[model samples]
Target chain A: MPPVVKIEEIHKIYDSGEVPVHAVRGVTLEIERGDFVALMGASGSGKSTLMNLLGCLDRPTRGRYLLDGIDVSQLDRNALADIRNQKLGFVFQGFNLLARTTALENVELPMLYGARKFTTKQIRERAMHCLDIVGLSQRFDHFPSQLSGGQQQRVAIARALVNEPQVLLADEPTGNLDTRTSAEVMGVFQKLNDEGITIVMVTHELDIAHFCKRNLILRDGVMVRDEAVSNRSFAATELEKLSSAEAAAKLTGAKT
Target chain B: MRFGSIIKVALRALMRNTMRSILTALGIIIGVGAVIAMVSIGNGAKAQVEAQVASLGQNVITVFSGSMSSGGMRGGWGSSPSLTIEDAEAIEREVTGIVGVSPEVRDRNQVLANGLNWNTSVNGESPDYPDIRSWKIASGAMFSDQDVRSVAKVCVIGKTVADQLFANGDPVGQTLRIRNIPFKVLGVLDSKGFNLFGQDQDDAVLVPYTSHMKRLSRRSYISSILIQAASADVIDKVQKDITEVLTQRRKGREPDFTVRNQVELAQTATATTQTMTLLLAAIASVSLLVGGIGIMNIMLVSVTERTREIGIRLAIGAHGSDVLMQFLIEATILSSLGGVIGILLGIGSSQLVSHLNGWPVLVSTASVVIAFVFSAAVGMFFGFYPARKAAQLDPIDALRYE
Candidate 1:
């Protein structure tokens, strides 16, 4: 199958009123369908800008970007918006759920803009199915403020998958969660990957990057390394180990 | 995005801040309300004036004698009787549009009837007086031409004179003594209420002009000629014809009379009321403008506050136009809602004002529709800048907005 995302020598420049800032300088990469990849970089490495370009939220300054075999770099604002709605989903570190909206409505947001028309019943059913996939079926009517941090991120993941996009782009999906909660979120992502959903996530932690099958590192707007993970960590097993360790610590404190 | 969903989203957003939305709409409410109320009052005043003019007489014109200069001391118009019974008869004979013409001679005198006395003006008029003045007799009949030719003292009593002189009975067939000359009441004139000048129109009596000329006043010339045109459209032409014929009869030395028509009086009254209404409506529209500004101000603030929400919607595949439409629809809904409420409030308040002040008020549907459309236009006009500002926001920048 053709690659779900293709970038050839893409460059992004930002005009900061004085000297121009080259946020992404001459980068090229590809990801096939169903591939689980993590992009890793330090601060100022231009990883976020690269993600924006790949997500079709921003156009490349020089070069072409093909999302699902279609060149999207030259599309106008409305066309890009349509492409984003039909073929892309994004998960942010902030969970970005509309504050007063319920989890089901948040999940339904992407489908509301989908290319295919959906009735209210279809929208509700599809949103409920996505919420079930994210293990948030019981929290469908709960608001983001009422949900825990981990659950809110799960709702965001459900929102990203509601439109059944070709690729899921997540930026620091676990940045605001505790260690065990991060592992729990990674477990949900692992299950999605096993079901043939392509995902490209950005993170700074090497340990979190190990949860993916492939890793790409950036340095100062350039690709520094690209390789398969020699020993990938299964999030389900890691989460089990974390909970057992916590249970053991609680037992020892109770005996003391 | 579908239109229904877009509206739903806008409604949701507005409901998130109900208090702010209501306050923003208040401006339009007051504006539309004031416009409707002021316009209604103006229309009512105009109608009242028209009714008063109509009551005086329909298509009626009056020819007043010119000022008389006696020994270089000039008296005002009608001070000298230049019009005559002959002139009134000539107008009826020569004018093509003249329906009826009556020579008038009036004097204030004490009228006694049924042992009760009242001070009233007694008018000596031709037999065609009732037809020319559009006056109807409640009972009995008007004096005939024979009555005028033979100098018969038959008269018609007005409603006010009837009530004051014959409090417990009808005045028709009763004897009324004017200038101590006993006159038989022929009929009672219909009540005309008060005129625009606040003068009681029914406090008068009508008699045969020959009777007044031969027996009471002994005046040879008549005071004025009350001419009724055939129709409203021919009033100006009739006035002109009367003026020309009178001038020719006087040998063109100088116009001995001034001709006036009710059409001119009606136009002047209508124009004044219309101007006042427009001024009031213009002042009321300022509030609508202020209301529009209120909407714009609130929309700007809402855009700034929802910067992150806009970013999220954009990232989720909302076109810039979608975001623009969302805010624009929000503003429109606010103003239109205000417009509807204002219409109701305006009508209610106008009715209230009419009840309290006893002033007639007519709420025209055209004005209501105009006020509504104007308010919606205000919403769209004032909403554009803020909606554009929101639409132009970069998705990447918006997502990062804290």
Candidate 2:
């Protein structure tokens, strides 16, 4: 059986005026179901570009991209959008929740866009369940602006989980959090992965990458290493040691 | 994106920026209001002109000799030196379109009846004059054609002249003087009030024109000849025929005489009034254009301000069409609000003015519809660019917008 993600000789060129810069030069990678993978690279190494392509926000100039064994390389804009909504969920580094919207509405966002034929009560109940998964069941009425950065990131996680996407892609999901909060988020990802959910994340920090079972490193738009993390750092006890609010307070500085 | 959801978001977002929305809508309001007010005024003037022309009697045509002027209107430029009692006799004799012809000999002067003597006009004309001018005898008859032949001293007095000359009792068999030439009143004319020109028709004394010529003035020249055509359809042809006859007689080659058709004159007056009214409206519409520009400016700012929100929505699965609709609805709501305000203002002011002047005003519901449609168009027209800008924003970049 094929892996859940398949890329064949993908080339992404950014055309600036008359010059075409090779943003991603012929990368091919794959990951099977029931795996947690991390793409690690330094800044300007096209890590974000590969993440954008993986998330279906952009298309490669020339390549065959297969997500869940479906040929998605040639999808138009609207089709790509629909695929993103139904097949993949995204949690960005900055949390990217709507500032004026409440936590519940933010979590309810994906279900509203989905074709699940859910009623208002069902949508609200599912959103509440997702928030409960992220352990933010009580902050549903607070706007994103009122929440701390870590809480905001958890709301984004709830939003990503509300529609039960086939894969959850987190791009530096703990980049804006402190050590304690990052450990807590990693614990949540591990717990989710243990429940048989497919997870992919991007990070440049080696310790953060250690939390994942598998690691993929990119350099100069090429994957240099693909390996499982050995003796990975586990934050199983640390997450339980601190409350979310106290853990979230550790991420008070150097956001983004 | 769901179309209904797009509109709902747009409306909610617009509600957030209350002041911007209202200001934008103000532009549409002014445009719509101006349109309604201008059109109503034009329509009112049209009706007024119709009433004034109708009062002049439907089939009336005046034959004077004149060429068309540069200013577009003048009555007595006929090259002819002669439009005699003879031409009136001939039109009465031969013209098929001629309904009635009264040789008008008007001489303005003061007249004395009693202690109530006042300045007034005296018209020397045939009995057909009153009926052609739609005047009815209030108490006594108009002077007969025999009175014209015999140059009798018989006279008809108007209501103003009647009230001024005789305080009470009948003015019949009463004596009045046109510059101290004693004339006995044979009858009193019905009140015709004022015509469109504000000229008082009931402030006159009527005597036979030939009597004015043969006895008092001792001149053969008729000041003007009042001719009534059979109907409006024949006024132009009758005008042409009158021109030919009078020009030949006065100028002997091509008469300089002017023949005025009441129907044609009425139409010209109506046209002039309509053009002026439209010009006023066009001037007012310029302010509406300024208002639309104000809307555009505010909408553009709003789009920039909401860039992050737009990005968030897009990431959540909103298409470009969704973003565009949201902004467009905001603009539309703003303009519609303004339109309602302007409509109320225009209606209120026009009513107040008409009431104060005691002038009849007709405001139609069609004007309201037209104003609203124009206001909506203004919103769409001004909102399009900002909407397009909002729609064209990239979701990734918008998410990162500060």
Model 1 lDDT per residue over B1-402, tens place: 778878888888888999988889999999999999999999999999999988778999999988899999999989887888888888988999887888899888888877889999888998888887678888889999999989998999889998999899877888989878999998998888888889898999889998988877899988888999999889889999998889889995877789999988888878999999999999999999999999999999999999999999999998888889888988888898899999999999999999999999999999999989888889999999999999999999998888
Q: Tell me the lDDT of model 2 at B315.
A: 69
lDDT of 2 at A221: 90
Residue-level lDDT of model 2, residues B210-283, one tens digit each, is 88887666767676788888887888888788776665555556555566777667878788878987798788
Docking class of 1: medium
Residue-by-residue lDDT tens digits, candidate 1, A1-256: 8899989999999996698999899999999999999999999999999999998998899989989999999999989999989898899999999989999999998877757889999999999999999999998999999999999999999999999999999999999999889988999999999999999999998889999999999999999999999999988789888889999999999999
Q: What's the CA error at residue A109 for candidate 2, in Å?
A: 4.8
Q: Please give the lDDT score for candidate 2.
A: 0.80
Q: Could you tell me the TM-score of candidate 2?
A: 0.79
Candidate DockQ values, in order, are 0.73, 0.32
